[model samples]
Target: MTNTAQPPQQPEIPDVLSEKKLRYVDIGINLGDPIFRGVYHEKQAHDDDFHDVVQRAVEAGCEKMMVTGSDLKESEHAVQIAVENPGLCYATVGVHPCSAKQFDTHAGGPAALLSALEDLAIRAKASGHAVAFGEIGLDYDRLFLTPKEPQLKYFEAQLDLAVKVQLPLFLHSRAASEDFERLLGARLPELPKRGLVHSFTGTIEEMQRLVALGLDIGVNGCSMKSEDNLAVVKEIPLERLQIETDGPWCEIRPSHASAKFLAGAPPMPKAVKKEKWAKGLMVKGRNEPATIPLVAHVIAKVKGVPVEEVAEAAYNNSIRMFGLGSMENASS
Candidate 1:
């Protein structure tokens, strides 16, 4: 096991505050987790665990969280959270192609996953709450479970489902940009309602494809170290951008090595609640939705906008992209 040396903690925020007052959304959060790699290792996401984190986020200036649910059950859980939380949270339902590789009890594996995904989509639509079809796309880099071909197979299948449902698509393209672009190219006519590419860390050409496809780019901890990502972000307009913590699995850190150390602890359940910034050099242990104000802080420095303005713009873009009604209703 890694040295469970607790990383430093962040300051708490006042209760009677609205991040809407500033203007940002930590839109992409994995409130329910299986503890994947990268920025999501601080919180132990078993089945349904989020109240504490949600409270922290509200205080930290993040008024909205568009959680990702990669399968039927997770999607249902996300919807439950949305319904329970009312406006602070919303959800996207889809079978992430990578996770879809595990679809079982079927004559054809890939086909089974697609069928299952379609069923989930139907349920979400029937529930009348699913905002988008997401956490679905290509990932040819990590050889975590199955091979690449199966992932590609179901990715297209889900893309087809998105078109059929006429819902926005929230995608995750990792080390499979060209393949992703080719598949997306074929789905162009229905691309206007396209979704965002979570935790974007690809090349300029890939970024171009994202922009061309009308998809939004999500920035998180890994983005902290990439000048290339910042360069791409600089070129991409704010409307085409978004932010996420992807927590309880991938803990975004101020630096890389630190991120690695916290790469296995369930996303920190929550930081303490209060109303002041800690003095001195800030050390990080876990990443949460609330930690996003710091992300907005950085983006503001780069985009040359007031931190509050960036927060609000990102917040509105998130609501607009995800079809989540309004930020005020969300955060309130």
Candidate 2:
């Protein structure tokens, strides 16, 4: 809840990249145990399933992938992937609220969530490449398992950890954006000016509020389907935006271009046709880092900038926000 660091004046990063020079840095991808194809569905498949799919993602455009793990075990797996993959992969450690439903304990359930986060925090600090605190926030929509309190507890704990470690955060908030805002209203995490609220599906008011609090928004393919968000992109200065595919999970279907994919995933072409908030494909459950460029294309169209410029800005913004600039190997 202390004052977050103020962001510096925006740098003049080039706005576009040539077709062959396109390099994507996906801020979100889940290539672990539960590969969770696309945006929402958890992978219930076998252990060997994601290797080929992830290889495809790597071959596509994902230069540096930040994988999000929903719980303790999954987080461990995500970290392992980053370790094995070296400079090509990165992971964030935190308990995603929706998946922590059974995490209650006696003597203040909040303590239990905090305790779990402590472990992730330690692991994250040790894993030099695990750069952020993520997929952490409230979800009023998924009320069946986790109630508001536990969700809030996990979110606050992760936020505090992020502040303590000087890492940025990748946040997730559904219908609870307001609640998320209330929790972070005056209490912005004391992070270097790089924290972001991922896949922002909230209203303009909520977007404005988060921006006011010194946080940026993660632009996934789903944001392209919403009129509100499109307007948000048109209005909210691009300086507050960053690209995220939320891959191996929320990829928008109908590949933006004919970049034939070699990865295996559930074919849910209808998902993108819905044209509502989800667009079925992107938010359905089968996303990967290879889908980053496609998402970036849509973001460029919405902002009326060349795809090259949008990609470059998003990449540079991500570097500046997550402290990747200091890492000698953190470059395209």
Candidate 3:
């Protein structure tokens, strides 16, 4: 009989809190998502508290955040956010796989659309508003939003653009690792600063493959949903691991496997329903960069390390990958 491999058991480790305040860099955030502006599903529900949200994350020790761009408009907005915030925020410019069909439906035509994306990336990089080029890759699980063909075609096209833009990538992959790796692998030699695969929830094998290919793995609440997820987090090399809130989504829930490790984490802001939102209060179910420490805490617990170690490593890894320079240099 053949035996299947099992996930290695993680030894129990005591959760410890360090007196030193650890800094973090949230490598992926949908800061331009309308939800941040009190708009949901195309309707304004409350006052825009964007600055307040940024304030909370700052108080929580999240010194830098990468505003994610999942499409052309979002990419433009991301750059603007970075420019306005300066060192506190940076942007990633690229279309997500779920939005790949926009290439076909764009009024400017596919060639013009790709050209525009390249233009944004190049311009933003010049001004230091953009750090990575992505949120682009394959997402087979959400084929309902976009067909497999366009996803494949546009993913390849974006890879070419990444080569031209010469920025580190901010990639995504969901249930499409085969084609994802194949396409990325072909372009590896040209992309010296191979980027991260954010919100990763893949298995040990997949994680190892990406790491072997010189890419980083980003972890968030979605990346720690189950026992299997914890195992994957444990195996991630400290140097190659980065953390993100992936917020306004991927909030850590009470039911998540990572929640058990949050016993000693810093207290999150008081949460209120969006309708009852007030200054300094977190919207009840919405995630924010303020929760980045909780992610580091979970990884530390699962890997039998100190929270500060995880926090420091993730912060440095993110800064290096995004080419944001030293935190001090960034502020100056």
Best prediction by lDDT: 3
TM-score of 3: 0.92
- How do the residues 1-332 of candidate 2 rate in per-residue lDDT, one tens digit apiece? 11112222332211222124466678877666343332224433322324444544444555677777777677777777777777777778777878656466434575665666666667665656577777688888987778887787767767776677666777888998767887765456445454788877777888888888888888776665556656766655577878887765555645422122213321212323212422112223456565677776666666677778877878777777764434743541
By lDDT, is 1 or 2 better?
A: 1
lDDT of each: 0.64, 0.63, 0.87
The clash numbers for all candidates, in the given order, read 23, 29, 0
TM-score of each: 0.76, 0.75, 0.92
Q: Encode model 3's per-residue lDDT on 1-332: one tens digit a residue.
A: 11112212332211222224589999998888778878878888787777767766776788899999999998988888888788789999999999999999999899989999999999999888899999999999999999999999999999999999899899999999999999999998999879999999999999999999999999999999999999999999999999999999998899999899999888776788888987667798889887888898889999999998999999888877786656544532
Ranking according to lDDT, highest score first: 3, 1, 2
**Candidate 2 lDDT for residue 118:** 68
User: Where does the lowest 10-residue lDDT sum fall in candidate 1?
Assistant: 274-283
**Model 2, which residues run further than 4 Å from truth?**
1-19, 33-51, 105-113, 254-285, 324-332
Which whole-number lDDT from 0 to 100 does residue 238 have in model 3? 96
